[model samples]
Target chain A: MSTDSAAGLLHDLAEYRARARRDRHGYWLPLLVFGVLILAAPLVYLPPSEWPPPRVQVSADGLFPGQIKVFGLTIEPLYMFGPGNGREIGNPMGVSWYWFGVVVLGLAGTVGWYRWRARRVGVETPTRLVVLAGSVGLLFLLGVVPLILGQALVLLFPGSYFYSNTAFWISVEVFVLAAAGTTVALWVRGGGPRPAWRVALASVGVVVALMSITIVFEAAFGHGHAPLLLLSVALLAVAAIERSAFCAVIAALFTAAALLANLYNMENVFYRFGFHVDYLNPRGEVFANLLLPAAVLIVGGGIAAWSARKASRRE
Target chain B: MSDHPTAGLDDVVHQKHRLAILTIAAEAKRVEFGYLQQNLDLTKGNLSRHITVLAEAGLLDVEKGYDGKRPKTWVRVTSAGRRALAEEIATLRALVARHENLS
Candidate 1:
């Protein structure tokens, strides 16, 4: 075949593939949901007003020491439930609990939305892959990443780690590292030569990033802000799943906002404008984190909706 | 085992319409019959015949199911089909490079 003909064929195939991928995307629904969820997060972080979102009470009545002795089992295998570590971090309502619910709902909502949209639009994205990406990312960021970073903190400043059990944590770190190393080795074995170097580069980069994030945030925001970074990672996973450059940009911006909120006292920005953040009400990092990421998602959803429609018309 | 890339051209997957079908189907987990038929601008019978040919060659898995009361035909590319498609693309890329070099 002639070069022009060959090139033309490739182009045609690529166009079909792009069209297929694009037709399947309903990312705007999830982006909007994510934005609203982020906006609602500060409420969970702050003291409630006259009316509050009803808190689901889990009674510790079932009696436990890392096990539901009544049932002789626990549903949560990764995190065995333990009783009474009732150390409060600012709010009465748990922000971590809020995030946990939101992340689960968000992933679940993604699957439901795609299935619903498929019934309407005739084509649907592979929701299984998207949900899988979100779940894996959720586990990595919420569970694994903090432990790894905690180990780094222990190494960098001895006796400075947040959790006190040094020996247990060391063993946990060793096991986690071995698991991660084996997984990396498996990926790199058949993935050509440079991947080993890339893995090393990535390891160094992650360590440097963890240290920098900790150092930067520790002075301004102080403790419990690490988990706040989890929100942006979910956006990133969806972006990767959809292969949407637009969603990826929004995710990056959200990550920056989350980092900024974590490090800098956002009330200072408000204070410069002669608007003091009322101590009684939600303010400061709460507002800063909420507005930027929500704006990114809510605005991004609008753009995605428009783009999807435009692409549909073009097709 | 000819050295020429043309020798690698897959007879089953080489035609333009079938290649387009594979390309589209390969993008998603599974593709609906109506969507493919509409996208490729093919008659129901024509597309069915093509699907049958690919299914017979073990390149496509055809499932007839109910989406409600309505019957839907779904097509998925098998592992062999993915390998075939990848080989076809590589061969095409090689063919283009060879042509470009001669020019």
Candidate 2:
């Protein structure tokens, strides 16, 4: 080939990589869908009467024994358990249940979306990574980490702290189920067994069904909600699958959103940047928790969508 | 070592389609056979020949599997393949620079 032909091949190589990335990573839809869902999540925390008086009743029982002072603001945590009722940042069981539904559904919906995309695009990206991360994280947080610490406390401190020894066995059982679920997922991907890869996969599907009913029950009614741990892990998995930097951003945003939602009033983080949500409503803090992550997802989705369009036009 | 950029071109990776395949495979963990076929604009048999040559040369790993009922094939570049592509691209860039200077 001529030198001109060689140079043209060099340019085409880049085009090919770009084309594969664009076609496989149709991640915008899920981002938009989950963004809307994230936006709607905190709506449940709205006070019964629009304007409740600014919280002033101090209580002795907080999630921890002390206040975290940040930027000269006594950062309000979502939960406080003292003898006197310490003010909760926003205590509504409804918010917890909503996130419970959103997370379980979001992860499940993502798997389903990939399956449907496989039918159309004819390229299968294993979604088991996402499910595996979510399940493992779920079992680890509610079971292993707490169980280990709980056991350590009981062993070292004795009567001072009471850890549940009975739950350890249950946690081990759920891990086995998760392992089987993963094997089935791999078997499906590996083209094992003669009659459709997942006649073998369904045998494994039953394991997943079992896990869905395990320690996750606690996540359903966690004090406020199981921090968007499920969503965060799932997003990270997709980031790896697509090799999309934008998806990684969405994952990081969700993780930060989850942590802030759990420990500190999200409004306080915004307060540090001179953006106060108090003027928005008496329940500004609740909106603060959900709003930032929501904006990130929607805006991130739009950016991804725009890039996809631009890529297609150029192609 | 040679004075000319042509001396740097890797024989296996210098071909147009093979270079494209390595570049695409390097962009993701692995790529579907159909994706390579479509993007390369080659017939299944033609693509198979190139893939076979690359695989035999230890430049790519071919995985035959299924996505549901449909048969699927995945192709990924080996570490040696990545090194080869990088070396080939660097040489091609040098050749292009030479052309630009001569023009």
lDDT of each residue in A1-315, candidate 2, tens digit only: 467976887788877776667777878877888889878765555554663535444455332223334444343232211111222434343444455567667778888887777556645566678889877765654454334332333443356222233443454465577667656565545444546544566656654434433333332223343446566777888888887887887778877866666555667778998887755443466567667777878898888889878977896
User: Over the stretch B6-80, how does candidate 1's per-residue lDDT look in tens digits?
Assistant: 888988998888888888888877888998998889999999989988989998998898888999888998999
lDDT of 1 by residue, A1-315 (tens): 566877899999998899888888888988888878877766666545533636455547652222222244232211201100232224433555566667777778888887777655556566665666666766654444444444455565566354344543554554456556645644556645756575775576555544444333333333334444555666677677677788789878878877775656667877897877766565344665457767887888888989888987886
Top DockQ hit? 1
- List DockQ, one per candidate, in order: 0.57, 0.27
> Can you list the residue pairs that collide in candidate 1?
none
Error of 2 at A152 (Å): 2.7
Candidate 1 residue B52 Cα shift, in angstroms, is 1.5
Tens-digit lDDT track of model 2 for B3-50: 798887777787888888888887765777887788889999999999
Q: Model 2: how far is A33 from its true place, Å? A: 3.4
Model no. 2, DockQ: 0.27
